[model samples]
Target: MVSYTGAVTPGGPAQTRQAGCLTITKLAVDPKMSNNAYLLQCTETDELVLIDAAYDAPTLLSLIGDRSLTAVVTTHQHWDHHRALAEVVAATGATVVAGEPDAASITEQTGVAVDRTVTHGDRIAVGTCDLTVIALAGHTPGSIALFWAGSDGQGHLFTGDSLFPGGVGNTFGDAAAFESLITEVSRKIFDVYADDVWFYPGHGGDSTLGAERPHLAEWLERGW
Candidate 1:
């Protein structure tokens, strides 16, 4: 029942939020990378799903103590985003889920096959709850975001390197890629969700749609 500030520090305590039927815990791992990992647990059944096993398998395992991990959902195939994937999946025996386009690359890089490939509009069940897959395909060929519309009427989005506070994810100077990312983020995200929707990015602290909405035009104009 603690207030969910969505703030976390590498190697520091996790910030947990209780939203209606779900409990969301955000932790920052890999001090140098400051990567953010999210644990979503269904309050009714205690079934858990990990979003982005970015680093430190030991720490991630400890956080999942005694709980059943239903799946490890990788938001993308970025190396830094799945560093602990193989180890975590090995320890927990959880199913691995990733965007279809990047699943092969993820498996190639980490040696752990993706158990399930998801696309936009796909629903991933976590016990009694469900996370809607939102494909934001620009940062990578298969970058994705997860959306949970809590019973409390609040929407929580986990954007993996696709959408951030100040702007969208890095497209590495690829104009076409940037366009894809920005367009998807605008149509699929900003246009659909309300201002109060809270978004958790791949790295750094969280942000609300309203806080970042005004800058969307600026970001688009700046083309970055």
Candidate 2:
């Protein structure tokens, strides 16, 4: 079935050629801990990338039919995000990409070589777009956001569980690092992407950088 693959960014290769933006396909999975998994398709290049694997392995594996996946990016390594990681790695033999602390766990869980450890300022090319890994570690020791440059003038951000619509994400999962994450999101994500950027959160529907900006004050007021 064809799905809503993506949102566009200005100057993106696909956008420049009038091709559609990133196509996002949502796979219903058990969060196990309030997380999610997503499949991203580059409309221009038809390249695919799995954001997280918080679902059933067999189903996630079946979705692949000899397609070349650029990478399997894990926003964090919570159980929900990793439940089906093994199946994904086994199915695609694709690169396993993720952040800091979870890198070892991811390697342990998948029992395979990790392709990359995403950190601040790291970038990965997917199809015709660049997925910038922006570090926001409150939710986990090394949570990162995928920032996509768009052709419609507004960019798209895949904030795993860092920022949401009404407010930012829940830092309760890792309370000790909660305050640090607030600063990290501000410095890494908010500072780089403008308010007009489109936010594709881990759980909810959608929002824009503008919509989520105002909440920063609230975050700070709550001591972030």
Candidate 3:
């Protein structure tokens, strides 16, 4: 089994956990930046897709090893998230997937065109597994999250700088942006997913809907 440590951050050490069938390996590409890059693999087929190629292309490639990297899904077009995108794609020839609205910007920043422009509710197939795209705009005009329903009947959400453990991601002090983030998260994520649904954010640690559900009112009251 591929060991998955809990989310890695600048100050925290790595820890491991096991999720059946679906193997999620979280790598802190750059500690100073606290940028996270995830490798989501279908254990049965060994087909994998990388989420956010933050930094260290060589290291990320090494982690992928002999497994075929079918795709590279950019949760958003932020430079910090795709710094190593070009290099990784060059090395692995993985198809680049980006949000439709952000596709042009992603290509502009990384110099690699997006092969697939995914929108909210679009499904991306990876071997035997599938990822449902959920547009969670706020941090950016085209920010998105990918929902993977595991064979065990559990759900895993990859929220790219949109939703986090403590509160929603930073909106640069924009009240409307914050409102949009909270509203979309509540409706698209919290409302649809069950309590046990675990979410892997763009940076820092992982969280569950159940854990963050009770704190919604507090989050709103605190205003991020």
Best-fitting candidate, measured by TM-score?
1
Each candidate: RMSD: 0.9, 5.9, 2.2
TM-score for all models, in order of appearance: 0.98, 0.81, 0.92
Summarize candidate 2's per-residue lDDT along 1-224 as a digit string, tens digits.
Answer: 32343433212211111214766555555434434456777777778888887667776666655677778898876666777777777777777899866698767766656678877888877788778888887787778888877667667788888887776667765556767777887887788778877777666456887877878878766743
Model 3 clash pairs? 5-15
Ranking by lDDT: 1, 3, 2
In candidate 2, residue 204 scores what lDDT? 47
lDDT of prediction 1: 0.94
Best-matching candidate per lDDT = 1
- Per-residue lDDT tens digits for candidate 3, residues 159-183, read 9999899889888889998899899
lDDT of 1 by residue, 1-224 (tens): 55768789888989998877888999999989999999999999999999999999999999999899999999999999999999999999999999999999999999999999999999998889999999998999999999999898999999999988899999999999999999999999999999999999999988999999999989998886
C-alpha displacement of 133 in model 2, angstroms? 0.7
Query: Could you give me the TM-score of model 3 versus the true structure?
Result: 0.92
**Which 10 successive residues of model 3 have the least lDDT summed?**
10-19
Report lDDT per candidate: 0.94, 0.70, 0.86
> What value does the lDDT take at residue 217 in candidate 1?
84
